[model samples]
Each structure stands twice: as C-alpha cells, then as structure tokens.
Target: MPINKQQVRTALTHVMHPEMEKDLVTLDMIEDLIVQDSFITFTIDLPEKNSQLESHLKEKCEEAIRTYVDEGAVLDVTTAVNISKFRDREDGRGEEQAFPGQGHRKKKKRQKDEGEEELLSGVKNVIAVASGKGGVGKSTVAVNLACGLARTGAKVGLLDTDIYGPSIPTMMDTHERPNITTQKKLIPLKKYGIRFLSMGLLVDPDQAMIWRGPMVTSAVKQFMEEVEWGELDYLVLDLPPGTGDIQLTLVQTVPLTGAVIVSTPQTVALDDARKGVAMFKKVNVPVLGLVENMAYFIPEDRPGKKYHIFGKHGARDLAERIGANFLGEIPLEQAVRESGDAGKPIVLEEGLESRSAQAFVELSNNVIQQLAIRNQSKDPTEKIDIKIRP
Candidate 1:
C-alpha cells in the first residue's frame, strides 16, 4: 500500500529527538511532508543547526518510516534551520532589554495586590534553581535536587519554567502528555518519584519559543496555578537563565521560599551568578545558597589528583561575598552527564557510593537545613525519613 502523510506523521511522533527526548512531530519539526506510493519525504525544521542532533534525528525518522510503512519503501528526509519566525518582535521602541553585563538594570516593581496571585495549594515550600547565564548546569542541578529531595521521602514537584529552553523532559526522560483532572487541573508527569512539568511536554520541541514578555509571564503563571501539584513538600522550579521576563514573572507571581543559584567556577559564570542572587533579592526572595557545578575535574585514573578547570572555589567565594550560604560543589564527571542524557538523574542512578551522587544528597540536606533556619518551620527531616527509591 502507498504511504500517506497522516501515516508519516504518526510514525514520526515515535521518533524521539536524541537531545530533546521528544518526537519530531510534537516538536513541529516535520514540515512540507509529501508521500507517494511507497515513497515519503519531509523537512525537519530546527531553530539552530546541530549537526549531531540533525543526523541522529534523521536516522530515527527513517527507521520509524520503515517500521510503519510497507517494506522496500523509499524515504527522503531534509533538514533546515529557520529562526526568522522565532525572532523577537520589536515595537517602536528599540531592544526590549539590555544585553548581559551591559548595565541591565530593571526598575523593581512592587508586589501585586492581595488576591491577584494564586498559590499552588498544599505546596509547603517553593525553591527555584536558577543561573545568571546558560551552560552552567542549572537544569541538571534542579533535576537532581528534586530527585534527591524525593529520595528523602519528601513529596517533590519539579516545574521546568525555562520556556525558551525547556530541558527537564529530556533530562528526566519523560515524554508523556499530561491528562486533565476532573476538576480541570493538569496532571503532572511522574519520574524518579518526582512529579514534573515542562513546556517541552506541552508544545512542539522543534519550534523556537519566541514569546514576548506578557505571553511568557502568562504561561508561567498558568503552570504555577493550573497544574495539580498535590501536597508537595518541596516544589523546585528550574528557571531559565538570566533575569528576563520569565524570572520576573515567576517571582512576582508566586511567593518563593528561596532560590538556589548554580554557577561554574569561572569568572564569567560567577559574575552572572551574583546577578541571579541580586535579582531574587530585588523580588524579596531569599537567596538560600549557591552551588558550584563542574567545580573541579578528578582524573578517573588518578582519583587523588584534582584539577581546577574553571577555577577553584569561585562560587564559594561568590556565595560569601553575596551573603548567601555555600551549599556545595559538584565536580565534573562523565557519569553525571551520561545519567542525565539517559533520562535518569545521577542522584537516583548512582546512589551514595559515587562522589557526584553524594554531593547531590549533601546539597539536598543543606537546602532543607537552610529552609528550616530561614522559616523556623517544623523540621522536614522529622516528617520524612531518607529513603532513596529507584
């Protein structure tokens, strides 16, 4: 039988992107699809050209087509990177916000009137994992933190509010669509004992999210209020890097208990990490601490030797300078990276045996301790025992 466009699309949905962990069809990557008798062709659109991702996805798409279509079918897949549609729309005014380190100062706005904001009911504390810039392993820290907290038997919810670069779905290895409850709340996806949600799950992965300030804020507000995050002891929000619209909207919308800043042991990253702490303070959110990721590299062959790749204790000094707690430092490790890419966090995959996994556990314990000191609330440790379930 001849191949059809609908059949091709259905097949494509099973072809998960290696990095995105979402199907091409869901990412809106499949474009200009044409099918003839036992022959099919489609264009895979990308926001940027990733030769590795493109090649991997192309192979997956071809494999999927063959499985769904008749034997001896011919498939032609093309790749295109078009970001024009995703460009920021400018009004009569010039650029909306200043670039990083270029005197980006936003006037602090007062909190909204009472009753204007809705809280996620039953969530005891909300913690945000944020960085001043990207490539500092903020998402990785957020994911592992959530898993670590869950390992402590706390009911945890991971909310990926990095709308522009949502990576939680891929890191957590979940691609299931959420179902709406009878009360009209969206059910959160579960993995590694943590309930989570991300824009990657709700929208096409391949499409660039070029939403304006208002739109970005609205989506985050909805995610915070509309999702049925039931009785969470700790709700960790993986915020997008920088103090942009999403960051402002989140702090303004919800009463954040605290924020954990992630940064590398590099001057540039430390500079941005300071800005992250400042932003939270501007919004009256407590800066719980700073976590230094990729702090050092320990050679696998020589475990005793430590090399300061980015710089030694850069984040620790920054934390002290900013008057925030120095949570802990996570070393550079291949296991951590491989675990995240495989859709399972290292904290859950490695347990307490490995050094990287132990760091995450220590980080989680410190977070709980800091919150106790900050809020003087009941001891979280007393409420739940430490139980790391696979």
Candidate 2:
C-alpha cells in the first residue's frame, strides 16, 4: 500500500487547532498540499502571528502523519496567514469567517485571563535578551544588561535559558551548583549584585544536553516555577538563538514586561534580528529595542580613531526600517571579550574611558527610559494560556 493525498488529509484531520477546537482540514487551514512517494509538504494558514501556535501545530502534524499514514513519512509543514480571507471578513463579504469578531475575541480574552495564575510572582519585571542568531554575542549582551540593571540599584536576576548551550555560568564565573531549599526550590547563585541561574551550574560542564522540544519545554518551565527569585525589580532572561520551543514556552509561562534584541553591525545578523522582532510581535511581546553589538572597533593604540569592523549601523538601519527603537551601539573591544571570559561583564569594568563599557551604560539607560514609557502607557501583559500540550 502507498500513501496518497487522501490519506495525508485524513491523518491531518486528527490535528486540531488548540484555540479553534476544530480539525485543520475542517477549518480548511491546509493548502499547497503536495504528496509524492513518502514525502509530504503543506502550508497551514494561521489566524495571526503566533510562533507558539505555529510550532505546536507543526509538531503535532508531524506526529499525526507519521503515526497514521507512514512511519517513515518525511513531512514538511509550514504556516501562512490567510490574508485574503481576513481581508474579505474585514470587508464583510467573506463566505467563511474562520475567526469572527467580538465572540471569538472574547473567547481569547477568557483564555488569557485564566492564565493569570502567575509564576515568578515576586519579580517586578521580566526582560528577555534575544537575537536572530548566534555568534552575534547575544549572551554577552544579556550578561552586561543584567549587570547594568544591577548597577542602578535595582534587584535583578539573570536566567540563562539557553539550555543546550548554557553560558551564564561561564560568563558570570560561578559554577557552584544551586542549593536546593527544604521546599525543593533552587536558590539562584549571587554575583555582581544580581542573582543568576543557568543549566551550566546544574549540570557537568562537559555533558551534552541531548533533548527534544517537549523535554526542553518542561525544563524551562521548571527554571521559572521551581526557582526562588524573591523580590527582584527585574529578571533578565538570556534566550537561545532563533524562535523555537523554549521561546514559545517562556511567553506561555510568564508575563514578560518587554524584550531587547541584540545584533551586530552586519547584514546577515540584522536579517535574523528582523525575524526575532517579528517573533516577539506575533506573540504580543513588546520589543523594547534593538542593541547593535560590535557597532565599531577601536584599537587600544588608536584611541583617537574608530573603525567600522563588521559594517556601519546595520542593526540601527534594521530598527529604523521595522520602526522599532534602536537602543545604542556597543563597540567591539578587547576589554569586552576579556571581561566576559573572566566572568565579569564589561559594564562593571571600572573606567568611564572604556567606550564599550560606557555603551552598556547608555544602553541600560535607554532600556530604562523605554520601559518606563511602556509601563505607563500599556496594560500589564497577560500570561498566555496555550491549549497545546508540549
């Protein structure tokens, strides 16, 4: 027996939209369905820009097809927004309104309200430091930002949520295992006026984390729910590169005050940074701003001059194009690299003369300014309750 389009469609019938409560096939969300031999690829037209919803559906569809149609089926699933359908609905002439107004919106509101049962209850604000990709010093920016916030006398906590490649321990230079409280909550390690936790601290340094999406999701949730982060003004999360299960799980787990994107002054890096900003927008998370790392370079001997090492203002141009705020630029310097390697971020490295160090100060201030404005102007972000099971 060979697989066919009918079988593929039938298998997908078992896949339901978490919020919609209807089979994808019945909702007619699937399109561009192509089947040949054991290969399958299709597009799922989604209602909005939801990375979590998209990731959840893609994973489930993969499982459903593999179980029902072919154990060896290589399925390629992608999601798209049915813009034409939405346009028709908005114009009041569409035959099918998959997501109608008022009632549908109320249903979503109820879902978000139900998720108000909180995590990180004592933390005043949560900031996620993310990027479009790696090798652009995302973790480095996160470490310094948290340190910078601490420098302002704000109680801060830095969480290294990059589970696969936890860098907070190495960067913060504290490798002692977190002590488990009598109640079993892990106490975060203290350093640089900030409490911090990372998978690096909990596991052997040489060990590799061989995990699937579901397991990673569970561990990330535990990092927030099972940790003792008492009475902090801010908790900065250093997110792993790209949008994946962990990022999706974070939004579902807590109400993030805002997010800060880090990128270098390079075309490839800024392109990924755009996707990062897009992912946050889809999830309804506010992108506080973009920080251009390695914006320029200055040789120690050439204290009177500057050089555009990567490219000039690539990240800044990206921020302007996307209409998001550009926080500031961080110059590449030996001090920044040396400071990170020694587990001390350059932001705390004494000397206002260090341009890289001073850049972090200015970036932190810009973040504070934007945060104050956002808090005053917007409602408290609601914790999202996704109906999908990890």
Candidate 3:
C-alpha cells in the first residue's frame, strides 16, 4: 500500500519548530509535503538561514514516518524562508512607495536618536533567567544551566545582562573582551561550546556602572541588537537581579519564548521570586518553571545526611500557590561555588558527578522535556504544572 498524505502530515505534526516551541503543522512551517508509494518529500519554512532546527526536525520526522510506514522510505527535506512577510508598502501598481505617515511632498528624515532594533538574531528561543533580588545566586544558576544545555548537544548562548554585576564571564571562565567586526557587529566570546556576551567584557573589573535608566537601556539594546549569536538553539539571558529598568526593558523588547525564575529555598528569596513570576505573567511572557537553588545542603562526610540550611521547599510552595511549574532543585554544594570561582562550570568538570552537578543535569533535561511537551500540546497557553519538594 502506498503511503498517504494524511499519514505524512500526522508524522510531521510530531515535529516542532525548535525556536517557536510549536508544532510545524500548527505554525504553518511544513510546506510542499508530497508522498508517493514509500517516498516522501517536504520543505520546512524556516524564519532565517543557518537554522540548526532543520536537522533536528528532519531527523525526527524521518524516524516518526518510518515507524508507521515502510522502514526504508526516503525523506527529502529542504529549508526556505518566507520573504514576502517583510515586504515594504505597495502603491496602486504594487510598486514600493512612501508609507502613509510620511507625506508624498517631502522625504521623511531619519531621526538622529532612533533606537536600535530589537532583533534577537540567530537565537531560536530566548529564555530569560531572572530573580526577585540579589544574593540569590541567580547568575550562577543561569551560567550552569546554559552550560548544561550546551553539553547535551544543544547550541546555546548566554547573555549576561546583569549590567550592575555581570558574572557570566567569570563563571564561564571567559575573560577576553568581544571584538567588533568591520561591519560593526559585536562578536560574542565562546567557551565550553557556548557563546557568551556581557557588559563585564567591555569595562574594567573594578569599575561600577553608575548609569541611569536610559543609559542602561541603551547599552542593553546594543547588546541584544548588535551581537552575532550565530544560530543558537537556546539563548539563556541572565537578567540583572530585581525587577527594575533593565528587566522591564528586556521583557518589553524581546519576544521571549519563556522565563525561568531562580530562587533559593528561603522565605526571603521566595517572596522575591513570587514578584518575579507576577512580573512575567503581567507582561504575558510564559513562565517555563521555577528552579529552587540551594534547596538543601548535603554533607560530604555523611552522604545520607541532608541539611535544610536555607529553609525547606520555599520555592516549591510558591510554585504551588501560584499554579506554576516547579521544575527541580539544586542542593548547596561547595563544588558549585568553587567551580564558579575557577571559571569552570560544574557541568563541564571532567567526570565529576557530584550531587549538585547531577541535579543541574537532571534539571536541564527536565526543562527540555517540559518545553517539548508544551510544544506538542494543543493549547499554547496551557501551563506545565510540576510540583517538587525537598
């Protein structure tokens, strides 16, 4: 029996657009699907070129179709972008003309103070890592989570938007300042297979950024618009501590796929984390989940002993109360801090599987799984409700 078109579409539905977090069929990404006998061919309409998602989608689609149809079926995949979406205004004869706002009598002058465009170029999904207040190890969690994702064969990028205290460069063991290309594009530093950009790279270590809100906004806008991230599967943004101007600017500027709020297992931290969740919800950015860092401290001498040094399950309780997903927790380990100081993230330490490291790995994997499930679900607004306690 010949393979059917409906069957091919069904298989394709299982495939997702990695960045959009939506099924290809629902997003109208699958184009030109043709099936004859056991041979099938299709085209995926990607938003841009050099997309890493193409290979992931192609591999998954082929595997899915082979399960239902003939095992030796051939699948051809091609990638192209829909350019007509960006076309300029058209006049009566379809020729480009001055927009309605600009009069035909005079050419519109370019404003000298025009703001930079909000283009998260080359990033498939932008995930912001935020906290309610400082001293919560928010940047630490962000750096390791990004590294963990990259270690799992996903192309990841880390943007340290903590203009006040950017720690990604130190935590990721990268110190070189980014160099601008002749085209005036900023190049991010690469470490452990993950590209990173930070304001820390631009200024002296001892210097403090004393700029006002507008200045900070401009600098952050430059970081987002000018950096060449180069086709990242996940761009993890380490937002500055607290919900301030920088956080507001980022949420308003970028089309964030979702956000992950990091908080320690303490009443103080949870109070702030609750506010963080409210902020993202108010802005309509999906909250992927909550990660409780330093949930507990495990003694090295007594492997079986666990200490609730920072109180217990504060974040988990908050997640439950707010009806949010509690992703997982990371125990307090000296190795986590030591690795950060040494500029080698715990996830990248060779063959060292401490409890904390394993927790991070598990947490990273769980995050991916949740995202995949959310992507496959029928309703886009449905939340993934996961409860965790310790």
Model number with the top lDDT: 2
Q: Assess every candidate by TM-score.
A: 0.66, 0.69, 0.66
- Using lDDT as the measure, what is the rank order of every candidate, best first? 2, 1, 3
lDDT of 2 at 4: 83
lDDT of 1 by residue, 252-365 (tens): 676577889999999999999988888887877778899999999999999999999999999999888867899999999998899888998999864477789999999999
Global Cα lDDT for candidate 2: 0.79
Clash totals in order: 2, 0, 0
List residue ranges in candidate 1 displaced over 4 A.
1-117, 205-208, 377-390
Poorest stretch of ten by lDDT in candidate 3: 100-109
Candidate numbers, best TM-score first, in rank order: 2, 1, 3
What digit string (tens of lDDT, one per residue) describes model 2 on residues 1-390? 767889999999999988779999998888656666676767776656688998999999999998999999977677765454446566887543222111222233445556573577666678899998897999999999998876665667899988778888889898899766545777677777677999767654344366666666667777788887865667899887887666766665667878999999888888889988888888888889999999998788877888998999899998999999999999988888888889988899777668888999999888878877776566666777654464
Candidate 1 TM-score over all chains jointly: 0.66
On the 0 to 100 scale, the lDDT of residue 37 in model 1 is 62
* lDDT, candidate 3, 11-54, per-residue tens: 77887766678788887767656565566766665545555666
